[model samples]
Target: MRLLAFGDSFVLGQGDPDRLGWIGRALAGRPEVTLYNLGVRAETSADIAARWRAEAKPRLVSHEPVRLVFSFGANDCSSDGGAPRLAAAQSLLHARAILSEAARTAPVLMVGPPPMPEPGAAARLEALNEHLKALCGRLQAPFIDVFRPLAADGLWARDAEAGDGGHPGAAGYQRMADLVAAHPAWRSFTGAPET
Candidate 1:
């Protein structure tokens, strides 16, 4: 499988010591994958939508199956002083465009944004997640909700309490990997079990 993962710093495995991030941990035992982690720090859905196609087209192999995984919205939910970086409706608009284009090119899967360890951020992100879930449903693409569960468990909160509030350590990344690896959609798409 040729996988191109696009999103924010979490997808980049920002705070992880090993630097493989969740994508690596999820595909840890699989040697057959050709992965291109195109996760950029502090990028919103708009940023990803703008750059993904240009970045992905050159790397796609004509003969092999390709997959695209998108995890964004965290930065979009962020408010510098007044409003969010990207409005919820605009975020959905970008997603619709990205997923529609991506599906025509390859299989598409979306991992909803994870919770921020800061106050009031979970609710904001949760709302974005719900909107994204509905959008993905209409597109018939698989969506994974990492925010609610991870937020409830406080794994990211704990990590933030220590340091690096935005990105979690190796364990948090592992938890994300486990979630994606165990998802039926992922298994069906990749034809591989959790590693």
Candidate 2:
């Protein structure tokens, strides 16, 4: 099976102690699976949408049982002096377009943005997640809310507070991996029997 993981630094496993971000960690020990980490640092939904097709098409061609995972919106919620880097509406539009197109080609899963230590960033991320969840519903795509649960998670919150205020450490990513592991959508997409 082939997996395409795309998004920002979080998807890249920024601050991960093992350097295998959550994606790598989750797929570890499964040598039969091939994973491409196309995550870029400081990328937003717009950046991902802009580059997704060109980057994913070649890899997906003739690749049987291909699946895609997108983790983004943190950077979109980021602010440059009181102004969001990307407006919520624009982010939603980008996500809708991206998810709709990707789902047509392959199984798609979306990991919503995580919480940031910046003041009020959590609320913004939550709002973004809600919108994304609704959009995914309409598009018949799977959505994972990494924001809400992580915001309430002490380990995740502490790790984020300690490191860069955005990306978390190994524990945080593991928590994320754990969440994905338990998700029915992930199981169904991978054809892995429920745990």
Candidate 3:
């Protein structure tokens, strides 16, 4: 199986001391699957929507099954100065277009962006998360919501607080990967038989 994980720096596993990030940790010891990490630093939803298809096309030429996992929005919600780089509405529009187009080529999974420990960050991200979840539901896509649970997690908070307030350290990334691994849809997508 070929799994392509797309997103911003979070998906790239920035700030992780061991550098596995969540994707690596989630797929740990799974030699059956091939992973392509297309995570870019400081990219917004618009940026990813603009380039993912072109980048993924060449890598999917083989006979192997292909799957796509998108986990962005942190850069979109980021404040460069006074306001966010991309408003919530704009982010949703980009995501809708991206997922709709991606689903036709391969099975797609949507992983919600994790929370940042910055002021007013929760409100902005929560709204985006809710809408993204709803969008996934309408599209019948598998969605892994890492926002709310991580927001309340002590380990997550500790790392975010100590680090850049968005990307966490090894422990926090492990926690997030655990959540993704435990999701029923993730298990199904990864071809792990149900427990």
Q: What are the root-mean-square deviations of the candidates from the true structure over C-alphas?
A: 1.4, 1.4, 1.2
Best-first order by lDDT = 3, 1, 2
Q: Candidate 1: misplaced stretches above 4 Å?
A: 193-195
- The candidates, ranked best first by TM-score, are 3, 1, 2
- Give the range of the ten consecutive residues with the poorest summed lDDT in model 3: 116-125
| Cα lDDT tens digits for candidate 2, 71-157 | 898889888769788889999999988998998888899978877877666678788889999999888888877677777767787
48-142: candidate 3 lDDT, tens digit per residue: 99999999999886578999999998888878556988999999999999999999989999999998766565678888999999999999998
Task: Give the per-residue Cα lDDT of candidate 3 at 162.
Answer: 80
lDDT of each: 0.87, 0.85, 0.90
Model 3 clash pairs are none
lDDT of 2 at 64: 74
| TM-score on alpha carbons, each prediction | 0.95, 0.94, 0.96
User: How far is 44's C-alpha from truth in model 2 (Å)?
Assistant: 0.6
